[model samples]
Target: MDLIACHDCDLLYHQPSIAEGRKLRCPRCGAVLLQHRHDCVERCLMLVLAALILFTVANAYPLLSLDLQGREQDTLLITGVIELYRQNQAGLAVLVLCVSILLPLIKLLSQLYVLLPLYFGWRGWRLPVAMRIVDILHPWAMMEVYMLGILVAIVKLASLASIVPDAALYAFAALIMVMAATDASLEPHDIWERLSKTR
Candidate 1:
């Protein structure tokens, strides 16, 4: 893959080979600029480690504290789901649990599923199915969505009570950042390159 840029203007283009479908260019400048990253697997692994740590913190502690009507209350991530479940919104509660809890775990696990084998240079087994699962799970891991939900709840409840953000909320935010970093750092071309070397 050739990364071409205009000498006269700051335009980038992804000069593709015959096999790479089609060439691409910078839309704004039309200078053939396309974004790409190098050493994606290595960078993604680093981000994954950070995300794992943040995920642990998010799940292990209270997300927020509230004082209302002369009473104190704190809610963990699971607690919110439980509260929803108790309110008879079983489906919504389950969806929350799935998105908040299960999806992150699946994303982490699926990443490991690919990373570990690739790291160890294992090419004996088929990974296409596992890759598909990773693709499906990536969109479902909604740390940012959960963070927005928490923020909205805090804003809506602030008029009625005193609220304090907790460490877990910060951790959740960090997890979102880490996930974004993983996506930005990981290059599909690098992964394919590694696979080609393995073959």
Candidate 2:
């Protein structure tokens, strides 16, 4: 038997075997204690794969093209980071790179590493560590915020030059949505239960 504590009311209860599409709630405060989503692992795995493909496309293509004075220039996702560094804004460059690029990549890869093996009924190597990393990096992956900043910059620069959204911009937008779906579909309690059983 397992035990769970209510986060809102500090009420303790025995964890029950909840069926898929079901939720366990705290009796006193009515706070949600646990939820069992149907086919969460499989759904999350597919979403993660899609997110990875989109990530690749987002990084490879130009996010936007600028045309001014009969000259055109293309900018990839990393282009802004590079420009920031060139402008001697090293701290801002690193912050953007970490929050927008590195953290998201790490979180996706870590989810893949953990979920892929678990889906196949095998325990992934260093499963706990990978899952921990995923939880830790969740808040730090700020792709949507970065996308907002890009949009703001585009609006500000519209009067100076013609700005055309590129393949990477669309891909990045899709990636953000897909990543959010993946997070929503993931059931951490189910994952931990599977991990414990496989050990």
Candidate 3:
């Protein structure tokens, strides 16, 4: 048996060696104390790989096309940031770059670093550090928030112009969902246990 404290209510409980894909809830607050994600590391690794591919596609292709006054304008992920910088919105540009691109990339890479080695029976050089980085960067990965803003923009612009969602937008949208699923399916405790066992 293991002694676990609920992060929400601070209630301590005795936890048994639960099976995979199971969850333990806090009896006092009804918060999830622990969960077993059934092959969480492998699933997270695959999802990370898929998210990376989609991230590439999202950045490579045009997010949307704007047809205004018989002229068409295409915009990629970086294009918006560059344009913002060019227009003297440097602060906003940097913010967008950090939350939308840099943080997500870092989170994905860190997860890969931690998972790939564990998957192949090899220990990562700094697994704990990599895992720590992932935890720190998780809240900063705002691709989904960016996607939501884009959708809101589309709704607002629909009344005035022809806004066509492009391949990159779809890729980004899917990337958001995949990343979310990856985070949900990931069990950090399980990873830590496996890392301890392997070492």
TM values, all candidates = 0.78, 0.95, 0.94
- What's the residue-level lDDT of 151 in candidate 3? 84
List lDDT for all candidates, in order: 0.75, 0.93, 0.90
> Which residue segments of model 3 deviate by more than 4 Å?
none
Q: Rank the candidates by lDDT, best first.
A: 2, 3, 1
| Pairs with backbone N, CA or C atoms under 3 Å apart (clashes), candidate 3 | none
Question: What is candidate 2's TM-score against the reference?
Answer: 0.95
Q: What is the C-alpha lDDT profile of model 3 across 1-199, one tens digit per residue?
A: 7798989989888977777677888889999877987588888999999999999999999999998877899978898789889999999999999999999999999999999999998957989899999999989999877888788888998887899989999999899999999998888888998888777
User: For model 2, how does the per-residue alpha-carbon lDDT over 103-142 read when each residue is reduced to its tens digit?
Assistant: 9999999999999998898756889899999999999999
lDDT of 1 by residue, 31-109 (tens): 5333344445666777787888888999999889899998999889899889899999999998999888898878876
Q: How many clashes does each candidate structure show, in the order listed?
A: 6, 0, 0
Top TM-score prediction, candidate number: 2
Q: Of the candidates numbered 2 and 3, which has the greater lDDT value? A: 2
Error of 3 at 52 (Å): 0.5
Candidate of highest lDDT: 2
